[model samples]
Target: MTRLHTLFLIGMLALLISTPTFALTGRVINQTLNRPEPDIEVSYILHETGDVTVVRDTTDSKGQFILDVPSDPGAEPPPMLFARYNGIDYPGNPAPAGDTVDIPVFETTESDTAISLSSHHILLDAQAGTATYIFIVHNHGDHTYLTGGDHGHGLEIPLPDGVTDFIRAPQGVHLHGTLLVDPRPIIPGNSQTFFTFSIPPSNRIAQRITYPTAGMDLLVQPTDTPVSTTVLRDLGDVTLGTNVFRRFGAEQLAPGTQIDIALSSPETASNLQTPIWIAATSMVVVAILVIYMRTLKTVPNRRTILLEQIADLDERYESGELSEDDYKNRRNALKAEVIDLSDSN
Candidate 1:
């Protein structure tokens, strides 16, 4: 090669080294119509520790768009992508930069026939005093299910014998022995909602799956009292970080399938509803809490530790190291610990 050509190639290499770029690329597709959705608005959310950044764009003629995301060394895994259609937000699977993701959206239907629980993870924990049930649900449907009724009762969750506090829900209103989130339309894909209600402290808790759930998993956190379920297939112990949990699994659960979960004996414990964390499995938050819980038991500065952990948890959530579901669950758990610690003092 000529010396002049070598010098030109070196300059191009220098330019590439001096300038760095991270591109988030993807497309929007309509699942119902089986066509690329053009002119739809899309947003790429960057979750960084203690911070969040949103980048917005419109899909082109071919239903594609690209956004330049700044590289963050400390950002959490799976930054989120969203496409809004028909007044609903459809989320693409979270992915890091330099990955292509498809945002799947469906046409809206007032009927609920296609709506079923793709997966349900029930977490029965003795937090504060009440027995709380957290349901993480997904809608495996080709169309968005619009909830319609006189009261918009598209989806209804019945309260067991005794329950209190609406806790948290994606959408709906509660009525008499039933928690109804009216117009809380079920969208296609994972994590449709995370909701909880507290029942009076008791040894046996009856949890009814109100939807025709395809598969379900029950996880009970470690407690002084033993926990077990006769209905679900015993999956044995599953360890998350240092915390060990007794897990059970179920499948083809028809609507109104009731499973009795036996828990600690009845007592009046403080009712603390933690609408914080929501996922069935989150290793990062689990690892973070495992360390935090250790400090809680071992250190004398329990309050100080909790306070610091709470702040740190917020940073992780904001920074994108934690999902909203896991963030909420762990945040509430930590705050509840703080409250209990204060009550003792």
Candidate 2:
């Protein structure tokens, strides 16, 4: 071989060996066992553009893992690592390449001891006759809640009335008769689950929420949707997605509390054509005040409006939601008008 050719080949081999390899380092700590865990599988997931890459490695005797990930030119490496134990995912802190982090895992349990409800939200689309139920459940205990040891009978999800068919549900959960059985473990922190169902055409629905809620909200879409409930306080209207909804909320409700809601539609076609009744549940108090005052000043023959105001006036009048002086002043005005009309004018 020529001297120059041999020298060139040797130089290329030296450069290849000099380049350093890229790797990620992390450790898995078993909180339940109160020590480091060995022989645990750790995964590193990276998504670049439309392509996804996952690298896996097992922990050593010291509970440490080193994943040798192939570095792409001008690409960024992911900083988070994940470890799964007892069907719950444990995520480590974000660390750059060549840095170390620790992931914590726990043992599994079937007991529902520390399980609590953080928030329960129900979204009802009146126009579509659909009801969607959402729940944010938290496990405050140190161990993960697993249904494995219970012989597939651990968690119970009560079905809302008028549930005809389901549109969406979480994975690892199946419907058994009227109730749903969820086998998925409720991991140590907050976990959210939701289900949507189609109901027959109706204006009323009742559901028995079986969890003790810290905060619960009931929302109905298309602000015009007539929704009223005795269990919750109207919190006015809140915009969600591209539409507006009537919002109701309550705090610290006991388990197995039933929530009943009803809707009303105008009987006549003229009432339907009457521009969307801005008198939603959120504005009921404001509407009552305006109606009582408008009737005192307008024509006296409009007894229908006066009767309507009295019919709709319930606990809201004395419920402290409206100012006491406001209603009293309107009452005086009505008396003055009655006296003037009764005179010879």
Once all C-alphas are superposed, what RMSD does model 2 give against the true structure? Answer: 22.8
For model 2 the TM-score comes to 0.66
lDDT of 1: 0.61
lDDT of 2 by residue, 1-79 (tens): 9999999999999978763447778889987787888888887654343344678998889898988765543333232
- In angstroms, give how far residue 89 of model 2 lies from its true place: 3.6
Per-model TM-score on C-alpha atoms: 0.61, 0.66
Badly placed stretches (over 4 Å) of model 2 are 1-22, 70-80, 149-151, 200-202, 241-243, 266-345
lDDT tens per residue, model 1, 1-345 = 999999999999998886354777899999899998999999766544445567888999988978776565343333456788876667665456667878877897876666666556665565433333334345556777775533565565666656655554432345634564545556665333444556555656676777788777666665344666767987888765546766788889998788877764534345253333334223323343334334323211233344455666766887898889878776676666557644442
lDDT values, one for every candidate: 0.61, 0.61
The worst-scoring run of ten residues by lDDT in candidate 1 lies at: 295-304
